[model samples]
Structures are given as structure tokens and as C-alpha cells.
Target: MSELAGREVRFRNTDIALMLVAVLPALGVGGYGHLMLGIEILDKGEPDFSLFGVAKTLSAIVAALGIVLVGAQLRGRNATSIPPLVLRSLSGSMLFLLATALAVILVPRSLNHFVRELQPLSVLTEVVLVGALVFLVLSVSSAWRTGLGTLMGINGSVIHALLSGAVFLILMEETSWGQHWIGFGTPEAFKGNLQNETNLHNFYTYRFELVYYSTAVLAFVLLPAFWPKRLPQMLSQLGYYVPPTWFALFALPVCGLMYESWNIIPYQIWFFCGLLTAVVIGRNDTKLRMAALIQAALLMLSQLVFLTLGHNMEDGYELSEVREFFISVLIAGYALITWRRATGEGASASST
Candidate 1:
């Protein structure tokens, strides 16, 4: 009984500590903005150099701590909520996001260099998307081979097949349907698009980008982190796919971008809700705690970088490209995880 009590105390303390770490970004950035700069929740004004500097400093500190925590996690335990392959893909994806952030911070003017359409970054993003498409297709095949459809009394291939189609569409958009490679011209109708590209997204999809962001939050963050264990398990038994909670961190950076209009109370709440949700989801799970902290750190760092750009960000056009790259990586990681789950290999399924 005494040992059990001691363990409970340790768990509580760890929860408190992790909670504080998760909210450090909000406290540091929001506090400084409101108290020192007198910026209100509804104020659309920009923070001065002092506030920006504080945000940058705080973000840097938290991001460094997150990296340290990741290193510690790697050293302390071989166990993780994420599959080995999935984790590797996520690591590479995060590197790309971080590299983009660094380029924006260190050389603000070089934003175009990293984000310009058809650049190396764009090519890399397409490659990842292709990889993801293949994985989703394979997942569908695996489902069929495993007879999940017959077992579940529904078409198991439907979900993943649709997912594959979605990814394929995204890939086509990214490549302008191979027009750049095939040397074809954009249709006259497409000439009115912002980029005048053959891609459908250039026409109007970018205008409703929040739809994409919101969908990601729902699929990756909210669903995975908050849904009960039985829910995912039941769905899996039914031939439905649910993202594992481990994905919240990888998805947080993209989710964080939704609130750049800092003056908007709703957007702030949106981002913070997701932030807090990720923390709550990880409260007791060791692997999830690591994931939440690392993701929260990236969240802070991304907020700082983009906020500083402000009006100059051109409605976050360039930043969106970087995020899309991250999203592609995330999708690939998800496909990997899904494949593992279907095959009953790798890490066990996660729950909140």
C-alpha cells in the first residue's frame, strides 16, 4: 500500500509537470502580449519588437526542451506509442518543418527560396505524397488480403480506398497534374487562379484552406486524442480506421497555424483547445507525454515565426506550402501506422 501511494504521488507530480510544460507557450506568448503590450484578446494589432522578441525567446527555450525530452525518451525506453517506421517518418517530416521555420527566422527574405512553387521543397512534398498514396493503397490491399471485409460485414477497403483517392487528388494538385513535367498549358479557365496553375486548388481550394486545417484537427488531434479506446477498437473491428493519439504532436504545428489572427478570440480558443487537448490526452501515457511536449514546442516555434511575419506573410501563402509539406509527411506516417495496426504488428494501439 505504501509503495502504491508513493507511485500515485509520482504520477500526480509528473502530470502537473507535463501540464505546465504543455502550456508554457501560451503563458509566455499570451501573457507577454496582454500584460506588457496591453494587447487584448480582440485586438488585431501587431505586437512590437519586445513582444516578438519574448515570443521568439520563449519558443526557442521550449523547443530546445522538447528536443531534450525527445532525446531522453529515446535513451530511457525502447517503448513508444508510435511504431518504429512511423516514428522515423515523423522525425524526417518534423525536420522539414523545423528547417522551414529556421529559414524564415534567420533569413526572412529567403521565404520564397524555400516555399516557391516547384522548388526543391515542393518536389520533396510531392514525393512524400506519393509515398503516402502508395501506403494507403497498400493498406486497402492488406485489408482485403486479411479478409477484414468479410469478417466485419462491410467493405473494409472502402475507407482506405477513399483515403487513397484523396491523397491522389492532393498529389495531382501539387504537381499541377503533371503539367509542369508534361509541358502542357493551364486551361483558360484556370488562368484566373491565384497562381494561374493547372491545379484545382489554385482556383479556389486555397480560399477555404481552413477546411483542410479543420479536417486535420478533427482527424489527427481531436479524434485520436479524445476518443475513447473502445471507440477506436470498435471502429477497427468494423473496418473503420481511426488515427492513433500519437499523431497529435505531428499534427499540432499545422493546427497551430489556424490561429494566426491573434485578435480573434475564437481562433485563439481553437488553437489552445487543441493544445490543451493534446496535453490532456498524454497525461498518463509516457510515449504520448513525449509526443505532446515535442509537438507543443513546435507549436510555439511555429506561432512565433508566422506571427512575426504578419501582414507580410501574404495571407500565409508561403507558410501554407510548408504546412502542406508537413501534412503530406503526416499522411505518410498515418498510412504506415494504419498498415501496422491492420497487420497486428509493431506498437499496440493507443488510447487517451
Candidate 2:
């Protein structure tokens, strides 16, 4: 549980969620998926696969460090204050943001106005800065050790959410840096981004840049307050009944739409199904464990099904490959759920 979502929502968790939710609608659309896959296959494009791809590679390093630090704390490695760790992370975050801000203001003006005129550079910048800010706050949260070590777990999820959301956005925006560009607020930004989507030579992540703004505002405000506690509790509550058998949900909205032959219906169904089922499933501690097991199993099953089916299909047709590394999470979630079910603690009420 400590390695997964925290016992409660914590800092930056909100930022990641808000960022992901905004794009999910587009990412889930069959048309969009097809378009993206086609680009990847036809254009021979790639995800950041770099050993240092900020999204995948570097995140893993931070996770390992954080996890080791967390474990050490648990096993009585608290000779140093967790607050300092949090502060260090936060301070680094602030420095990065300030430098980015300065670069946006000073650097772009030096380039030709035409470069500014045609590039979707500014909005791309927002994705990086916003993500960085979210992490900055989350890394330094005060409740890092609160709630039965739940805060650490929640912090991890918040980190995942933030990192995950950032990767998704970077994939949308063609510019890797996501720094400020010409035309900070204008129609040209949108037009430029749409144009960039077709040039498979360069990858662009977000399609509608304005959508990014609203998402940033939401994550910045609400997520930091509850990301550490809310998401885990909610998932824990969901486990009370639904069982993490979420792979059942992969085609959730997409296939739903295809079957109904109506564009909006499938997504609407997915939204409600996912939301409602999560609520109805959880009842008490014992059930939460069962739910975790099923959910973990679902992840395994989903990945297995995807690979099995994916191998047979042509490229771009496979269900999303959101995780190149999910097996570890599968094991961890299952083990924790099992441990909790075996024990009689958590959520203040008795389940047995």
C-alpha cells in the first residue's frame, strides 16, 4: 500500500489526475487512438524510450530512491527528518520553474517572430511547468508521514499521476521542452499545434491547448490538497466491492461506443460505469483486500490479453500500452491487499 497509492490523497496527486482526466476523452476516442497509432507505425515514431526519457527513465530512478528512502524511514532510518527530503525536492522544483520562466521570457524573443508565429511552443511550455510545479509542492508536503505511512504511498501515486500525465501531454505536444513560445495567447497557437500533429517526423501531445489551461488550474488548486489522501481512500473504498478487475474496463468507453454506433454513448457509459462501479464495490476491510486482488489480477489479465491479442494484430490496433512495466505494480497491489485483508486494521471501522 505504501508503494502504491498512499493511505490518503497528498500533494501533486491532484495535478496529475486533473491533467490525465482532461486528455482521457481524446485518448479514448477510437478516432484519436487510430490517428495516433497510425502516426507511430507509419511515421516510425517513438515514445521517449530513452534511458533518460524524463517520463519513463528518470521517473524510475526517482521512484527507486523515494521507495528506498521510504523503506529506510519505516525500518527506523528516521535519523534525518522527512521534512528535509520534502523541502529539498520542493526547492529544486522552484529553481527549475524560475529558470523556465526566465527562459520563456528572454529566449523566445531572440528568435525570428516567424518562428514564434508558427510554433505551438508556448502551450507546450505550460505542460512542463505545470507538471514541475505539481511535483514541487507534492515532494515537500507536510503530511508525508501521517496516516499510518499512507501519506508516503499517496505521495507515490501523486508522483505517478504527475509523471504519467506529463508523459501523455509531451506525447501530444511536438516540442520536447514545452517552453514558452511566440504568441503566448492567440489562435495561431492552436492552428500551429493542429498542423504539427500531421508531421509525424515530430510528435505533438495535446490537441486543444486551451483545454490544457483549464486542467492546469484545476490540478494546481484542488489536487495538492487531497491527492495524498483522497485517491487512495476512494480506490480503497472502490475495492470494497468492485475488485480491481479493471481490465474489464479497457474497451470500456471505446468498445462501448463502437457497439452502440453512437460516438458519445460509449464514453458516457464508460464514465458512469467506471465511476458507479468504483463506488458500489467497497463495503469494509475484507472486501478491500478481495478488490485489490481482483484489481491486480485484472491488470495482469489485461496485459496478458493485450499481448496475446496484440501479437496477432497489426501494429496500432493493440489496446493502449500505458505500462511497459506493470508486472511489479501487479504484484505489489495484490500483496498489499492480501496483507490488509489478513490483518484487521484501517479506515477506523472493523471489517471482520
Candidate 3:
């Protein structure tokens, strides 16, 4: 009984500490949002360099912290069990939503310009894509490091090369390889469709979307599901090597598609594909299977909420965006915990 009590205390302390760590980013996002709101409310439409600088600085810090925390979690063996991790991540997500609410209260029309540019969401999409790129690069590196590259065969090598090239292209286009930051001039032919002076997506219109969707379907869905015996053996082996949670990473881009088009087809495809993948790969692991199923259901619910009630909530605060953002955060958080578990198991299996 004494040992049990001590364990409970330690668990509670750990939960509190995790909550604090998660809140740091929420605070930074809220602070930046508040400053931006003030600028819009007071200065009409003019950009305030001082406030913008502060906000950018805060966002950078938050991004850095997020990366560091995720890295630590990946490398360390100190994570709580799944139930606790889920609860803590959900709590952290709620806190993040609360911070967004505070920012909304500070300035009602804070998201107006942001909505026009589809900012933050756009940024989030880029970040996810970049993350996928990193994952693929690391996977390729791991395959080579383990001498699994020799076993990949010609078909597998071709697929790997294709995926690598595609990911690199997408990442470059998303960031414009720092061209946006450096204020590179847009071409005369491309000026009309620009989202802003910096972004080319408004002009391009779904060019990369097709690329991403097709590649995702090919690499993650079709090959694994249909070609399981022949060409995709190496790909399937690759999937087994990585965390099962990685399978859900494709959902991010699909969600972005839903947000942009407000179409239910993307959501349908997302749900079905997620269900299929879960059923196919999670034959052995109940936890991973359940995680995939839950992710799909939650994603569907988010879409339903956004479609049914989002417009009604868009009076001043852009509650729709806020809701969608929080939902995405929750999904990502859930995925991270599951990924850790899956990878940890994989590591243990490999060692044995």
C-alpha cells in the first residue's frame, strides 16, 4: 500500500510536468495571436514591425521547443503508458484550445487576414509535409544502415527513389527553399495567382496535392494492400520497420484537402483508407489497430463538426478554424504516443 501510494504520487507529478511542458507552446501561440490582434484592432491594417518581430520570435521558440520535446520523447524510455499518455495529450490539447480562446477574446477578428491567406493552417500543413520528408529520409537511412537496402530489389529501390524525390520536391515548393523569407521576386507570369508575395500555392492550385495524394496512395495504400506478395514486399518490410503510427501521417494531407475544398470525399477516402490500413497491418497488435480506428473515427467527427457547425461559429472569432486546429493537434498528439509505443516495441523485437 505504501509503494502504491508512492507510485501514484510520482505519476501525478509526471502528469503535471508534462502538462506544463505542453502549455509552453500554447502560451507562445496565444501571446503571438494576442499581439497580432492588438495590431489589427489599433493600427487598422498596417503591420507593426515591433509586434510582428516579437510574435515571430515567439513562434520560433515554440517550434524549437516542440522539436526538442518530441526528440527527447523519441529517444527516452520515460514515457507513461498509453492511457495516461492519451489523457495527458488530450488535456494539453484542451489547454491549447483555451489559449486560442483567450486570443480570440483579445481580438475578435484576429483570424480575418489569417483566414484570407489561410495562414497557420498552411504553415501547419507545410510542417507536416516536412516531417514526412524527414521520416522518409530517416527510413531510407535506416534501411541502408541495417543493410536492408540490398534486400529491397529493383522495384523497391525504384519506389524508394521515387518517394524521396517526391518528398523533396514537395518540401522545397512548400518552403520555396527560403525564397519566401529572402523576399525573392515572383515571376511576371505567376503574379496573378499568388496567395501573397511569398506563396505560390494560390497560383499553382493543387499541383502538389495531386502529387502527394497519388504518391501516398501508391506507396502506403496500393502497393501494400494489393502488391503485398510481389513488388511491395520490400515496402511492406519497410513499413514494419517503422512505427505503425506512421501510416496515419498521410491523414494530415488528406485533412488539409478537406479543409481547403470543404468536400466530404476526401474525408471518406481518409476514413476508408485508415480503416483498411489498420485492418491490414494491425492483425497482430490490438493496441495499434485500435489506435488507427480511433484516429479515423475522430478525424471523421472533426470533419462533421466543421461542416455542420463551422459556418455558424464564424461570426467573429473564426471558431471553425480554432476547432479544426485543436482537432488536428489532438490527432497528431495521439499519433505521436502510438508511434512511440509501436517503435518501442519494434526496437525490443529487433534486439531480440
TM-score of each: 0.68, 0.24, 0.46
The deviation in Å at residue 143 for candidate 1 is: 0.9
- Could you give candidate 1's per-residue lDDT for residues 1-352 as a string of tens digits? 1122122112235545654675577566667768887765344444334647456445534533442333222211121345675577556645655766666666655665766766887888999998998888887877677644332466667766887899899888788989867879888978998778887776666344646665766676655554432323334353136565556656776655532444433345446555565556456456657666666677767676767654454334566567677777778877887676555552355331
lDDT of each: 0.59, 0.29, 0.40
Query: Which candidate, 2 or 3, would have the higher TM-score against the true structure?
Result: 3
For 1-352, candidate 2 gives per-residue lDDT tens digits of 2343233433355445544554444334434435653322112222333332223223323332332232222221011122243334333323432332233334423322312322433333334444443433343332232322233345433443454465444433434333223324324334464344332223343222223322322222112111222244445432321112222222121111111111222222322332222222221123233332343334333333332233333332111211101211222222233233223232222111
Off by over 4 Å in 1: 1-98, 149-152, 231-240, 257-270, 309-316, 350-352
Ten-residue region with minimum lDDT total, candidate 1? 1-10
Model 3, span 1-352: residue lDDT tens: 1122222112245544664674465455445456755422111111123654445434434443433333222221111234554445434533443344444445545555554323776567556655655555554544444444233453333344455676566556656555555667866656686454444555654453444454544443333222211123334344332322333323322332132233212223333444444344334234444444454455445544433433333343254344334333433432343233333433432211
> How far in Å is the alpha carbon of 129 misplaced in model 2?
12
Q: How high is the lDDT of residue 157 in model 2?
A: 36
Ranking 1 against 3 by TM-score, winner: 1
Q: What's the true lDDT of residue 65 in model 2?
A: 33
Weakest lDDT window of 10 consecutive positions for candidate 3: 39-48
Pick the lDDT winner: 1
List candidate 3 stretches off by more than 4 Å.
1-145, 151-164, 192-204, 210-246, 249-267, 272-285, 289-293, 312-352
